[model samples]
Target: MDGLDVLADETALLLASVESLDIEDLAHPSNLPDWTRGHVLAHIAGNAEGLGRRARSMSDAVPRSMYESLESRSGDIAWRSRRTVAQHAQALASTQADFAYDLAGIPADRAGDDMEIRLGLMVRIGDLPLLRLQEICVHHADLGVSTYDWSNWPPALVAWMLPRITASFAAREGFPVGWVEVEGARISVGPDPTTGVSGGATEVVAWLVGRAPGSGLAVTGVDAVPVPPAWL
Candidate 1:
């Protein structure tokens, strides 16, 4: 199966996760530094809408140049996050519905057709599915969905994200300090990143994302930062 299949599966999983959130849980802080469960759902749903829109535009051969500006993307993110949590949930459902209905309108085989996309670069339409997966997988983990074991994760995603996550940890708040322990390797993100793997990857990733090594990370070492409840 291709990334589209992965996206579809991930979407369904995301939808289920959103559905399962009780208001109490939604109000609870997620593993992220400053987001609640509600915020996580909203962010995930918003990303789905954004990505689905990008994919549909590509299928229709429409030129999208708005994302060329990082400022523009930031503005959009801010706008989406501003919506009420309920509205954000509805937006997620609506966006998913639209994608499901519209997928049938475009020939599935045509998704692989390459054309000038984002910033006029040529990429196979099929690659968008992977992009969608990137969104889902990262956000899913951002919400602390540990039911899906690391071993069950898509290796493609792990390989692609290891460096990015490391970079994020290194540049976070522009500190670029501290040591990161993941899996069996340790990457010293502060002084050096060659620390390689150490203990549990999930623990390290949670810590890097502003949580503790266990459960929902509530503290950071050396400098304790009270993660705001809005980091979902």
Candidate 2:
């Protein structure tokens, strides 16, 4: 299956998980610092709405910003947080469907059209789906539920993300500049990547995204494996 198909399946899983949660469970803290599960769901729905809006703008050749402001985003999430778990689940599912609907009209040939994202940086419209997939996959695990983990990620998604994420790390300022080996696949990042860190692809992705400690990874040519800052 293609990445978008895989994303659709994964999103179904996430929706099922959210739908299964008890109303009280919404108040529980998520893996992200200081945010509750409700907050996470709210953000997910809000993101879908934002991306859907952008897709519409792109398809129609209309100019629109993906996000109004950081403060507006936070406020919207806060407003959505007041809803019950069922309400939040409905919102997430509806917004996700809307996003998929919007994307259906955007063919690959036109996906590369320039568009501005939340940070005011312009990027290809084609990148929107991948970004949404990342959010769903990562945040599903972040719900702190027993069913989800780094290893639970789709193998295709893992393979696809490995190079992109490592390349992003390599491009960052002050990155440790090292070799990361994930289950025999080795990638060198930065100008002089002298140190080598080896581990399972799951652990590597988790650590690279700041979602896990590097305890499971083996390090060589360095005193310790440096934890990277949260991915942008």
Candidate 3:
């Protein structure tokens, strides 16, 4: 997939969702625990800025950190979440554009180069676009906008992300030992397969990533579907 092209499209969709909200709506609670719509927006903007720095760091003789520190990153999110609706919109638009510009400037030959992100984790320069894409798409849903919920995620994005997301969830400390059955493809999330959660790919992925409540899914070997660990 042309990651940049996909990222641009998703970003535009997220921007429109944000633009649709009134100033008073910013204070409303999001799908995420204890975070208002404003908090999600602030995090999205901060994420774009951080990822943009990572993209630019790939070419610098001296690479820079994605964020100064985890505490500072959290602090910035808290601080910026208080901005007026217009300020939040401007921050979101500008940071996304800067991120795209920085990501596009990296040479194809340097796509595999690694840069440090939050908590000293390293990611490939070429992966920044998709990383930012995930952030925008997921947080856009986090805004608790019914029109832009997980069900509205682009099919291409879900297809590209499902396997990776399942793998990541399986690796989490307390994930259940079971299989995730989607469209006849049974993916083993843990050591055992006695339990199974079957559903459409998008719904399964959404539940696995804590983006949605697992409803209308068929479950076996357990009274109810087990909640997976947090993805992030």
**38 Cα displacement, candidate 3 (Å):** 0.7
Q: Pick the candidate with the highest TM-score.
A: 3
Q: Residues 1-232, candidate 2, lDDT per residue (tens digit)?
A: 1368878888999988988898788889999888888888999899999988888887787877777888999999888876887798789889999998998877678766777766755556776777788788888989989888776887776776778788877877665647899878779865556788888887888888887787998987788888776577
Alpha-carbon deviation at 107 in model 2, angstroms: 3.4
TM-score of each: 0.55, 0.90, 0.92
Model 1 regions more than 4 Å off = 65-90, 100-124, 145-152, 159-195, 198-232
Indicate the worst ten consecutive residues by lDDT in candidate 3. 115-124
**Which pairs clash in model 2?**
none
Q: What ranges in model 2 sit over 4 Å off?
A: 112-115, 120-124
Note the residue pairs that clash in candidate 3. none
Per residue, candidate 3 scores C-alpha lDDT tens digits across 126-167 of 677777777888889899986798887777678867887777
